[model samples]
Target: MAQPHDAPTAAELVAAVREFLERDVLGSLEGRTRFHGLVAVNVLGMVERELDLGAAQDQAHAARLAELGFADDAELAAAIREGWLDGRYEELKSALLDATRDKLAVANPSYRS
Candidate 1:
């Protein structure tokens, strides 16, 4: 976690820009420009959330796939489609839920709540 960057770190830089957009840019624009600024703010928020949660989510997903004896997502999808886990429906359901929650925690955390 050593932030050996020049001055403002990545998170700090993102925060600064987001604050600027929210406080300054958003109010100055009208019509389509304002709409686009709103979208930009949302996209920036998503990027910040991903930066916060993406690494841990990826690690957990890879570990889950490994535990399930699959090399990757495609293999897992193939197994699911072929009804290979029919007997373990509950377990599969829980795993899929966890995966979805993890993704949503980054993509749209409010939905997870």
Candidate 2:
């Protein structure tokens, strides 16, 4: 919902555009154009999802990274690649799985099925 006079929120605007593309534009395209339109629709859908879920997911991701004793993804990856987390495999795997699930929840919820 919008905080100012119930005006359309950014997420609502993005959803509207995505829906318009899906309903009106995609069907009118041909070959490469249609393919590109489909990609555009998918991208818009992803954007809508991100707008809705990004904040909470970002917090969860940050917590996971902190739990792994890292400052960020780069640090976490470096630790893993350098074998620093070798002995913490299960812990690392659980945190990674949680992060992946959060990502999929926004990117493609059906993928987990």
Candidate 3:
């Protein structure tokens, strides 16, 4: 096995591959192939964004969940489904919206606009 070095992080490696695909492979393709290549590049971009933002988003999600008095999504969902959190609908909605925006920021920042 090869030893791991810290210089090129996972995000960096993904970005390098994404750049290569966009610069070299994408320009040579046409029609459906080019479309698929674009999709692949977009997926790689999402991965890179996730690598950069996932940790902070996760922490924010957990904090939101905790603020709502739940341990995890399942618990929160159960409470909502059971109508136990009906009185806190606004609070829940705010938390959910924040979480969704965080996800959108990583998946497609344009969506937030």
Top candidate (lDDT): 3
Candidate 1 structure quality by residue, lDDT tens digits, 44-69? 88888887788898999998888787
Model-by-model lDDT, in order? Answer: 0.86, 0.89, 0.92
Candidate ranking under lDDT, highest first, comes to: 3, 2, 1
lDDT of 2: 0.89
Name the candidate, 1 or 2, with the larger TM-score value.
2
**Models, CA RMSD each:** 1.8, 2.0, 2.6
Worst 10 residues of 3 by lDDT: 1-10
Per-residue lDDT, model 1, residue 97, is: 90
Q: Write down the worst ten-residue block by lDDT for model 1.
A: 1-10
Candidate 3 lDDT: 0.92
TM-score of each: 0.87, 0.89, 0.92
Tens digit per residue, CA lDDT, model 2, 19-108: 999899888899999999999888888888888889999998899899889989999999988999999999999999998898888788
Write model 3 residue lDDT over 63-96, tens digit each, in one string.
9999999999999999999999889889989999
